[model samples]
Target chain A: MSGASVLYDVPGPKAKVRNRIYSVLGALAVLALIGFIVLRLSANGDFDPARWDIFNYAGVRNSIRDGVLATLQVFAIAAVLSLAVGVLLAVARLSDHRPVRWLATGFIELFRSIPLLITIYAIWVLLLNNRTELGLSDNQPQFWALVIGLTVYNGSVQAEVLRAGILSVPKGQREAAYALGMRKTQVMTTVLIPQAVRAMLPTIISQLVVTLKDTSLGYIITYEELLYSTRLLAGNTTVGGENPYVQVIIVTGAIYIAMCLALSALANWIERRGRRAKTGIGVVEAGDVGNAGALTAAVAAEAAADTTADTAN
Target chain B: MNVLLDYLPEFRAGFLGTLAITAASAVIALVLGVLIAGFRVSPIPPLRAFGTAWVTLLRNTPLTLLFLIAFFVVPKILFQGASPFVLGMLALGLYTSSFVCEAIRSGISTVPVGQAEAARSIGLSFTQTLRLIVLPQATRTVLPPLSSIFIALTKNSAVAGAFSVTELFGYAKLLSDKGYAIAVIFLWVALAYLLITFAISGVFRLLERRMGVAR
Candidate 1:
């Protein structure tokens, strides 16, 4: 059987009849649930065009556009800063010195365990309280607070991601680098990290997508990001005759989904490109010459087993 | 320290509230996740498509947006009299279920195909095969990732505080508003979270040691 068929079997005649009955019942159940939800929502005027028409207003459009821009700005700054911090922490965790490694591990664990919202709230309050002493300008503290909280939390996560990637690299590569008289940092930057990055690129990019979505947490602190602005827009009666809370939320949620999907698409493209590049550790054919036939035989045996399994199904 | 003692009742309430929310949402998420995973691996094409769509849609949206929808829209449409606690629970549960489904699906994939094939050959129904032969094996492999999801659920419960749910962060905010030090209050809150999460990690680690399959 193909991989897809492994989890189930092709039904016999009797079983097919039973499965058909099950299929119909299941589909009807799902449809009934959908219909009930739709009827209820319609009863509440949630589907009314007037509520959704707020999107057409110029002021509402501008506010949404500004919110999108602000959200993107925060995401971009946080993404870059977090990646930088992640690298620093990963290096620190991998340091030969015990204290450095412990310190890095402690920081990552502490922030990782804390909720991103609390971090942002704490930072926002801290900055507001110390704004005069710190010489921070108005309106910038919120932005900084969001960015810093994201940086610290996501940086800790990315550090673990990078550390895992680095660890997955073969120890032989690092030994080879040292054998060539390279220093520890040089070995890391040149040999291990480069390969580690290629291996973990998909994970890194996915975490970045996560970071993008997480920018919404700024709403809790009234940072005027996409979700926060949606709330404000929903409350503004001038935009639409109704509250438009449902409509604004749906639109904002769709925008977030669009952004995250785009990031995921990019991650997929890069993953495919990386696969095609095949920049993994090259095998040393010279040393493995004698075992080549054995290796090929092992592969042949595995293929035969797969074919047998397929035929059995 | 004196300030923390003064607000001991608030702190206790907040801690318990956070725990209750996390437990409720975690249970909801686990149930939804298992069903979604079943749909994902089902033979029926429509079921697979529906499962995929649900996971993709829910996963892409932020938890905060989910909460907004739950708070502002869902109650109006579905549960008119539900409290913010219920709304928060629904949002977090729905949002986290996607990740849980993904984890469970991956675990299901790790179960060797031959095992399922064997069960099917012995006249087991698809659901029977999953329950009897597949899920037990998948559960063992899934424990680690499942624990991580719950840990995340614990932290994400903090967002409910934003909706005035009186969770730990909410209590912290209340104290800060009443002339307490912001940094100190936050520090205590963070420490509380750390304690809970670390305890969770310890439990999972012990479970892993006891039940994990040696590769």
Candidate 2:
């Protein structure tokens, strides 16, 4: 049979046999590794039915459910706020004023470079230290700390995504908007940003998926997120006489995977819809922008042609 | 400031520990990523399926969950006497390898099909073509993204602190517990991370400038 690879021709008789031997050896090697892992795990009783029994308990299930809810709550707040921050920063970075652009750039770079775990931890500590002065109520500080940390980090990432999207728009669109006598803000808000957002929606949503996963960092600050609750459940003997560490981890990890995959699937769906809509300026027919003089000359020639066509009509 | 000055030695040790963990895990992740990338592009259906499944599962799951599993389950089931440091490295390495695999696979795709076709027409096997002709070109395209992934790996080493692996953040936690100002301790920790990450980015930028091919 012919191979699917465009790079390679169909294997001849002896080559086919050699390829078959290689494939079998590779498959056997992978299988042997898996078998070794399973055997070792079973020897240590990791697969014992009793070890998994705790997950069947009502209390354990409820705790896990509550953990999932808490995780979602943090994620929801962070996701919305981060998008808002991202837009603000991206706009600021693109500002006409030099100072505004520099400040926004600095903020994004600083947060992006630092470890997210440290950011959340620091915010949690600060909030805890200032709890009385700030008049924060009833463990709200942990929630805010997680949300804020996530907002800062992911917001910076989203800003870059949005900026790239905006930059990718054909320069003619911007010139057209300007020719319509629109202000910079008006052009940005009404024309450029909307199209940019549509173009980059897939990236924005995937970043949200990342934001969802990063919520687990709250566990370090002792926030009762899903990972923290799993740790608690695994360590507590009341759930079961034995530590159901493996079982709890499996269940919690599966929940995370399900959520992230759902987000990604949604992103794909939206991307397909956006492609179908195709609602923007068509691809630039002109060649590369080249130098400023060339671009201005092209625009001038197009403007003259437009005027002549208008007069003839 | 006094607290920082007094704990400078501890902070130094922690910084070194963070670097060590990041370096070790990065090496492991790179090797694993190459193998996984090969699997992903292999002719065998099972290998491709396994590679896809591994990347999807690992990439979607929270790194924290992986760390917890490493700390709690792995030692009990796999390596009975391993240190938290080793477990932390294992978790970080495994989690980051998925991202690295993606970077590598995408890099591989960027290498023109014609190059591979030429190699194959010259009687090179798939492995030989990939190793000799494809990967070297792919590396040029892959370096920028690969560097970012490693930068991410470095920042993620902070998670090890939670598992009691006395990296930078762990040391900050210790100082905070010892009556140092919590805000100051963490600010310093964050600054240290910023320095390291910036250095990594700067080095990568230099490497890219020197080695990158103009498209």
Worst 10 residues of 2 chain A by lDDT: A285-294
lDDT of each residue in A137-256, candidate 1, tens digit only: 967889999999999988887777667567667778889899999998899899878876676566677778788988999888888888888788788753334587877887898899
* Residue A147 miss distance in model 1 (angstroms): 0.3
Candidate number achieving the greatest TM-score relative to the actual structure: 1
> Model 2 TM-score?
0.90
Tell me the native contact fraction for each prediction: 0.54, 0.54
List the RMSD of every prediction in angstroms: 7.5, 8.3
lDDT of 2: 0.78
Each model's DockQ?
A: 0.44, 0.42
User: lDDT tens digits, residues A131-179, model 2?
Assistant: 9999987768888999999999888877876675676667899999999
Question: Which residue pairs clash within candidate 1?
Answer: A1-A310
Worst 10 residues of 1 chain A by lDDT: A283-292
Clash pairs (backbone) in predicted model 2: none
* Predicted candidate 2 versus true structure: per-residue lDDT over B133-190, tens digit per residue: 9888988867766677778888889889878897998898888877777878877887
